[model samples]
Target chain A: MEGIGIWGVPLAIFAGAIRVSTPFIFVSLGESITERSGRINLGLEGTLVFGAMTAYAVAVMSNSPWLGVLAAMATGAVFGLIHGFICKFPKVNDIAIGIAMMQFGLGLAFFLGKPFIQPVAPHLPSIALGGWSSSPQIQSALNINVLFIIGALLAVALWWAFKNTRVGLILRVVGDSSDAARAMGLNPDTVRLLATAVGGSLAAVGGAYLSLFYPGSWNEGISSGQGLMAVALVIFARWNPIGCFLAALLFGGAGALGPALQSVGVTQGYYLFYAAPYVLTLVILVVTSSPTRSLAGAPGALSITK
Target chain B: MTIEANIPTLPPLSAQSGNLRPILEWLARRAEPVAISLGAILTGLALFSIFITVVGKSPIDLFKLMYTGGFGSWFSIQNSLSRAAPLLLTALCVALPARLGLVIIGGEGAVVLGGVAAAAAALPLTGSVSPIIVLVVMAIAGMIMGGIWIGMVGVLRHYRGVNETIASLLMAYIAIALMNHFIEGPLRDPASLNKPSTTPLPAEYMLGSIPGMDVNWGLVIGILACIVSWILIEATSFGFAARIAGGNVRAAQIQGLPVGRLIVGFTALAGSFAGLAGMVEVAAVQGSANASLAAGYGYTGILVAFLARHNPLAIIPVAILLGGIDASGGLIQRRMGLPDATVLVLQGTLFVVILFCETFYGRFKIFNPDLWKRTA
Candidate 1:
């Protein structure tokens, strides 16, 4: 910002967007998969926090970042399993339960996570995406993390499976109409339970990314509703996995705006910048949630849709 | 597809005992919820005890300490009651809109914004206005801001088809951001360098304790608000319209009720109550606005609201019970070397189990008096 002229603003915002979108991509995709199975787990925020704590703790203890990821995944799966079982009961409101589970998860994490706050865990390595650039600034800007690629790949895979696979067909059938699934001699509850577990593990991976890579440590302040935003991202993406990936990147970009500006030497009113991704999400929700056109890929049984 | 081919038709009820419905129906309605609540609490405690044992603690000692620490003595009872004051209003925030079938869980945003608004409004009249007038103005400003915030969510849900749950949450994030901006910049009391809070109201001007009690007047105000809400929901036409809409939205529309207005009105009223909680926190407890204003009360109120089945009158006792648990956290921490979050874990566990137990309400034949004949 000192000598780079007026172009710095947009460039900084673009850079910030990439950095911030990482967690969003992971969590949103996880939510997309769970929601596709007819159960909405609102507690992913807690999962994200707990995942970060587990990853950080494991990394510190074993000196292996990959092991941390695995540990986090296991932790997330257990959380998901609890949610699935509780929701399977008759007349239970999954959304309210999700909120309760979130609080429970956060409490447990805070109770146990107090010990791992100060350690330097093994961090994930990044690739130089901007290697072609000669300038140091450009080279640094191009250093993209590995998790982003993995997130994108997962989204594509989920999209394809959702379209062509029998398992995906069953999930959609269960999500669309449980009575229809019942008629087909399938248990809707079992499918949803498995889906929630899978979704929980994926969301934990997102949490692993937060602690093992970006923001790069476990602490109480690590996540600020990236888990909850994933739910909104699913709606914007119309519950398409691939769309969730792109939407997450967009959210990440919004999240990065303030920090990018701060890094480039414009630190005025940084709090306003922090509100960017949430504001963007609200705007997108209002715009996309119109009564006029049919939401092209919406699941028939979704409660959010009128 | 296979099950569709088979059916066993059953006839409707026409028994002698069913014919004498009024007296039995009244008794069953009163007993079912209490029985379910007790059953759920026992199951929750058993599950939680397992967790405590795994962590190398005795559940019996924990319960004993929690009870004594929270409500064993007169002093502890007052302490628990003090905590219950804010909860009462926050619980109302969720309870009110729930009647209209909208789940508004973003009351923390209203509480924070309302507190900030109250402090900001009072800043100008710091020395000139009478303390009573200033407090009234603070409450009004806080309530108005809160009402408008949630009311907007309700409007968006009705007119634009936006999901109120997400919209309200997003709005809450925005409100917090705004509070941070104002508190850290424009509203920051230069003298409060350590904590970066708004200027504190002088002690003389601050809200004092109620006569014969250590707690402030917030408790009375919150209880009065609950009573008024109960009257509105149970004894008025507006409440009736909201209830009808909650029961069958499409049918309510067919009946020519202004569904949009009721939705927005109920949510707005709910937000106002949450905002009033913030105001009371400002005027009664903190005597100024700070980060403490967003203390997870709003989220906890969601649990309280659901646990009470969104019943306005039922919220009072439930709020106090939860409050006692919260207040006991400090004592348990000191006595058992447990983490402060133990109470939070207990609350969360209880909430999850209770909600899951909603499935059991009419399932058992003995509990359902109409189905009792089948057992005989």
Candidate 2:
């Protein structure tokens, strides 16, 4: 703690936020897409963990981090497909089924992941944003991973496409009112299913980022609740892709608060800091649920609205 | 077959047509849930078997080990019963709330906090108070802690319109952090250095086993609690009001039922049951509060409650059955080269399949007495 200057704290925190926000950005953007299409997949947390395991195993075995990312995307799509198909059934509660799927997904991952915990995996490379800086701390803080840029670009692309494309209108119409889509003879279920698959794939890419990039390893403890937090993050973001990107960064910042403090000679009550993101999530939910004003851009058919 | 032969024949359907038809239909309707639940169980078994086959493992061997490890012998049965004890209370934690249409999954939080509170209470009373009095006080403290925790969720749902499911889950996560804080910081026992735990209760003060059985007294208490819960839900006005409220909020409010009170009361009672589960784990098993208090019982209770169709009496058997499956996990891992999480996979699969089968409740007419042709 002695050699660190006053600026070290803020700089390290910024770097930590970028490193941590990568997963949240992917997951929240994925959720925002799904919610925009009038469906919600609460099982993405499971998908994320499973994706992490799949990516870690693939990267470890084949020494191809890129292949690991693809494998994770495929696995996530399969999970999303199952969630979509089951939710299409009459009388089935999607929320309850989401929880069950989360459990099942986690179980299957742990069962299959038992042997891959110890192995090292191929890591994603980082680009230094502060190559001109003289201090190692400054350079480290500026070193951004590839996923961060990709996530930012994805958010921009999605925000643009959702407003400009024909498919976006169909999705919005379906989400706003299934009856209107039915009147237009469009299959609401099909649109929702496709949206969910795409969302699941993106979330898996986030998981791949966890395993093959930051913290680069295959282990059971790689994820905590980053996947679950994305649900809250999407809500905080008001269902906008760009909003998801910023919200993810904020959540990532909060997530790193504890570790960052520890790094800066504040080690007591580490558990309290570990709880910051959840607390932030809970507060956001409470605020959003208040009756004073409607959530700015809530999908009309979203069941979460009271 | 001999048992059926020895039984007296029931009267023919047509013999008492006018008076008996409604009664028979009523009975048949009452039987609907059990039939559907059984169908779901069968479906789950089929799915599980398919999974085993795909993995190149013999389902029969797995089933054999599950049964043998769960109930074949006296020791195994006792072990299963011990596991079932906390599950009974935890399942009730979910079941009681379902009567009021609340899906409260934060029983894990209540259990963890309850155990911590109970231990915290017991520490000061160890010297001056009689062990029995201290234990009773601890139980009360445990129940109070749990009740307040979940009751808060119910209150939020009633007044603030918070979703109980998510709220309770968030609370559970928070409760775990709180427990970890206490165990690692304030309540750390000096002797137990590596694993943080509260000071252990004296041996005499700890809960004992039931006479003539190796099972602890917690099993009896759990069974009794279920029976009492069954009576409360089935035979009380409060239960009736809660059910009405659960069916339709607008209708209940129109009928002048205090929906808010019912919601809060039911959730509080549910929390107490879960809290008691934590106390039992402490007093009977662990004899102290530790990180193990969050052991997946709270989550398992959700499956048990659903499997029982939220029936308190039915939860007893379902919890016992799940307990048996849980007891066999180690055997599956050792003998079949399966991961420890194999049991979790089975449980998760069963849960999802059963919930899916819930849609089939009234689809079959053969099971409905009203659809039965005249059997002269």
Candidate 3:
């Protein structure tokens, strides 16, 4: 305490930011892709929770955390597949469908995952980026999860791909206008279907990071609104993948406020501090939204911005 | 079904003896929604039965237990009605805003805050004031608090173009957090060591059951609220304007309709119902504001509203159906050794199947009268 002095709180928060932001990054990036393909999946929260359950159960059963990740991705893809297929029908409200899917996913997860709650699953490995630092505090603070690094790189790659790739062009065309995508001879529905599945899979990876990594565990209270928060994060990022990475970091930092305060013995109103991310997101929305104009870079056909 | 009975014969007939198109068209139009809802609910139940069968539980036993526990006996019916009381109001929370084309899913926020407000408002009035005065004050306080909480979502949506669904959800999280803060901090009753709730109301002031039944006054209030909401939506110019606005906001605005006010008013009114539910809980059930006030009734209310197709009158039957399912949960859990989440799964399956069935509306040409019009 004496050696670290005033730096301990900020250091803990910095580490907390990186650790906490991993899930946000993955979910938001997935949401961005889905939105870019002219659809939105609010049920990602359900997917995230179910993914965590699947990951934890699989890891415990198979004795390998990576297998758990694959299992979660597969389950999440199926959830998306159902959502995408149902939404493709005429007059079906995707938002309402998303809500229904969320409820169904949550119910199924809770019912099925009840068995795996007590077991100890394998944890995901982390990278030691601070070998140069001798202090145990510094070493622990700089220890980063592999998923975080992968998510960061994926963000960069997605940003570049959205600009340069033919797939990106088709997605954008489908998102902006189905008629235009049809003119280009692309089936917008099929593209959106794939995009949604990919999005759900990415969100599941985020969930795998949750149960297999930091604060890792299989329980009902594992998710504290991270899935829903990703929607806000994607909106704040203006649908940019790189922006999602940055925004996730910001959200993660805010999420660390409570624990950081607790570390310093300022424990009063801790729950309020836990609400910082939501408050921040709400404030961002209130400030940035305009009635006369749609959000800049928002997918043209996105139901949310419309 | 009631709507079908109440509506006068609108299609003019030539009485040409052989022309049955108009009559058939009218009946088809009237029957489509009922058929869809019924079909979807059955399909959902079938899916759940398969899941249950796969798990080695007999679906027949489950449904039988559900019927016995929910609607079989007078006591069970009373239990179902009691639970349905809160849902009636909370369903309005989702239904009203829906008429304005806003999907607000955060009624839970209003419910918690409303309950807290009711308990807090009643705290000082307990001993000195009469029970009736205290109850009225608490109800009003609860409504106002809930109104403000959800009304803020409508305000944000209209004034700032914020997405109502996300805004309402975020606010609900914030509201719950705030409720917890207050309950565990300033409002904590020192004597309530285990639960950490506000001071409980006096026994006399607590809401009592109706004279002849085990059901509380909340049921009657809920029924009345539904009727009033129906009248408001169906019989008034305000509701007409709201319907027009919901159909097309741009068109409504061009016609000089008060779209913004309608949005705010309907949301606030809807939220007040959810708040009143919280108030009812505090007064009749919990006797204080506590963590239980944030129960998933708000979420279930969303299902009720959607099942009813956002119609206030239709919410009555839907809420009762959901309430019966909820009441039977305990029975199913006890009799079958199934977990409590079975009900949630059933609900989720039903909700998904219903949403999928939405594509079926107007799909059948028989339901569309224009297609049946023969050029005489």
lDDT of the candidates, in the order given: 0.84, 0.84, 0.89
Off by over 4 Å in 3: A130-136, B1-22, B373-376
Q: For candidate 2, give the lDDT of residue B52.
A: 83
- The most accurate candidate by lDDT is 3
All candidates in order of TM-score, best leading = 3, 1, 2
Tell me the tens digit of each residue's lDDT in model 3 across B1-376: 3243345754554567347765777788899998888899899999999999999999999999999989999999999999899999999999988988889889999999999999999998899999999999999999999999999899998999988998988888888888888888888888888897999998999988999999989998898999999899889999999999998999999999999999999999999999999999999999999999988788778878888899988999888988888899899888999977788789889999998999998787767665554434
User: Model 1 - which docking category?
Assistant: medium
Q: Which prediction has more favorable DockQ, 2 or 3?
A: 3
By descending lDDT, how would the candidates be arranged?
3, 1, 2
Q: Provide DockQ values for all models, in the order shown.
A: 0.58, 0.50, 0.70
Task: Name the regions of candidate 2 deviating beyond 4 angstroms.
Answer: A1-3, A134-138, A290-297, B1-27, B190-192, B212-214, B370-376
Q: After superposition, how far is residue B257 of candidate 3 from its true place, in Å?
A: 2.0
Best by TM-score: 3
lDDT of 2 at B99: 82
The lDDT, on a scale of 0 to 1, for candidate 2 is: 0.84
Query: Lowest summed lDDT over 10 consecutive residues: which window, candidate 3 chain A?
Result: A267-276
The interface root-mean-square deviation of each model, in the order shown, is: 1.6, 2.2, 1.4
Tell me the tens digit of each residue's lDDT in model 2 across B1-376: 2243344764465655867777778878887887777877888888888988898999999989888888989888988899999999999989999888888777999999999999998999998888889889888999999999999889878877776777787788888888887887788787887888999988988888999888888898889989999998889999899999989988999999999999999999889888888998999899999999999688778878887889999999999988888888888999999887888788778878888877776677755664566567
